[model samples]
Target chain A: MSLVMAGVVGALFGAGLLVSGMTQPAKVIGFLDVAGGWDPSLAFVMGGAVVVYGLAWRLVRARRREPWFDAAFHLPTRRDLDARLLGGAAIFGVGWGLGGLCPGPGLVAAGGGATTGLAFVAAMLVGLLAQRRFARG
Target chain B: MPTSWLLALGGGALIGAASALLFLTHGRIAGISGVLGGLLPPAAPDRAWRLAFLVGLVAAGVAGAVVAPSAIGASVRPLLAVVAAGLLVGFGTGLGSGCTSGHGVCGLSRGSPRSLAAVMTFMATGAATAFVAGVVS
Candidate 1:
């Protein structure tokens, strides 16, 4: 059941990328180029998503229990803007501007058959693994 | 009708829908950062939820390709660059204690002040990253 769900979720996410042209790095680059050719399309997408998620959140919370599965709600507790956050954001930005492939879209790109995605995914896993190895309590 | 708009709507809808589904079925917030965080240690008895969440995420992409042939295709971005970017994000997520899903989508929607700060940091870093990459490379 989990496998089926993951596959479905991944597909929809990928399709979103494909449909939004986000899976294509050039498009992302184009959007990033403010002076040359500023494409605000991604921003619009972000806005729309924000609106939808806002409403859905309410509907979900209204129910005593969730509509489908059983699990606890999770949210971050950390508030300080520390080194990890600062440094990581710096690295992520560099990658986005240089590579235009963040984790979500990167995963979607790989699923779409981009060889480069394989590398990104591999590195992402490594990053995840590295964090696990060195995580502090 | 427009390709760009289509892309935005599609991605946004998928993400929003997935967010809603995750919220409905599981009481989980559908934030990627938190979802991945569960992998850390002592393996919570609720490990099944995390596993299921990740699986559904991937499956969504897989099924989309099968059904939406027009949506699946290779992408750009060099492999090495993307790998570096992935590592950066891994580190960033660790530091920030969340990612776009947790903050940009779920956090902000939930009226989380911290999420607002995190999202701001994410966009600022993203913008700066693009600036340097554009100028340097």
Candidate 2:
């Protein structure tokens, strides 16, 4: 039941990505290209999402102590900022600018059978594995 | 606001609602990288929900392609660029412990300082990279 609910939530999220034009590389690049012809559409998307989620977070916390499906809420507890976080984000930013597709949109597009998406996902998996190996060693 | 901007906002709302739903029901953050990354070694006991969510995400992508083709755009970047971007994205997200959905949307909604820092770093670097790419290309 919880798994089904998770799927439903994922579907809704993916639909949102499509509707917000996040699946389009050109649109993403346009938004990132602040020095060029900047498109503020992505900003609206982020703003709208953040507002809604923020409200929901407050409401849910006020009403519920625990989730419906899980015994405890699995929220991140880390408060400290470190070099790993900053360096990783910097690298991600460069990749995002170059390809204009992050993990969510990349997965959605690949699932829809785009060759480029597939290629990107494949390389991404490789990178993930490589990073894991390096981290372990 | 333009019609497109409204759509973007609405879509973003939907995304937020989905994230909220996941949190409210399952006590989980809709962080794509973390959800997907946890499955790399497949040791976690809550893998079912994660897999289900990804399946639903992919299904939505397929449905969106059929229902609203125009919103899903094709990639114009070359194979080499796409692959390189994918590598960077995967490795960076792994090291950073979050991506756009996790850090940009969910984390910001929760008002996490780490997330704020991550978003600022990524946005700055992303915009800078886009500017450089524009100048070169």
Candidate 3:
């Protein structure tokens, strides 16, 4: 039941990505390209998402004692900023600029049968595995 | 604002709604990298939800393509560039521990200082790279 809910949530998220033009690399790059012809359309996207989520967070905390499926709310507790976090974000930013695809959109695009999307997703997973291996060693 | 700003805003709300549903019910952040990353080693304790989320993401993408073809776009880049971008994104997200949806959307809403730093860092780097790469003027 929880798994099904997760899938349903994912689907809605994916649908949002599509409708908001996030699945388009050009749009993402355009928003990021401040020096180029800047497009502020995505700003609305961010604003809308933030506003909604902000309200939801408040409501959830005020009313919900426990999550529907989980015994308790499981949230990230790490608060300290570290070199790993900064460096990784920098790396991610570069890749995002280069390809204009993040994990969510990449997965969605791949599912849409784009070969380039498939390639990106494949390499991304490999990169994840490599990073994990390196971290462990 | 571009003509598509409305769409972006609406779509973003949907994304936020999905986030709310997942987080409110499960106490999960809906961070894509973390969700997907945990599945790499196939740990059975929490694999089901992640897998379900991903499956739903892809399935939704496919469905969206059929329903609204224009919402999806393709990334036209060299195979090598695509591969490199994918690897970097994967590794970076792994090390950094979040992506756009994770850090940019959910974390910021929760008012996490770490997430604020992460979002700024990645957005700056991403924009800078876009400029350096000549994608931005």
Q: Which candidate achieves the best lDDT against the true structure?
A: 2
User: Candidate 3 on B80-133: residue-level lDDT in tens?
Assistant: 888898999999999899999999889999888888898899999989877776
| Chain A TM-score, cand. 3 | 0.96
* lDDT, residue A127, model 3: 89
State every prediction's TM-score relative to the real structure.
0.83, 0.98, 0.96
Order the candidates by TM-score, highest first. Answer: 2, 3, 1
Per model, kept true contacts as a fraction are 0.49, 0.78, 0.81
Q: Encode model 2's per-residue lDDT on A42-96: one tens digit a residue.
A: 9888888899999998899899989999888899999899998998899989999
- For candidate 3, the per-residue lDDT at B119 reads 89
Predictions in order: lDDT: 0.64, 0.89, 0.88
Among all candidates shown, the one with the greatest DockQ: 2
For every model in order, the TM-score on chain A comes to 0.81, 0.96, 0.96
| Better candidate number, 2 or 3, judged by TM-score | 2
Poorly placed runs, candidate 1 (over 4 Å): A1-10, A65-67, A77-83, B40-45, B60-77
A best-first ranking of the candidates according to their lDDT comes to 2, 3, 1
CA displacement after TM-score superposition, residue B107 of candidate 1 (Å):
1.4
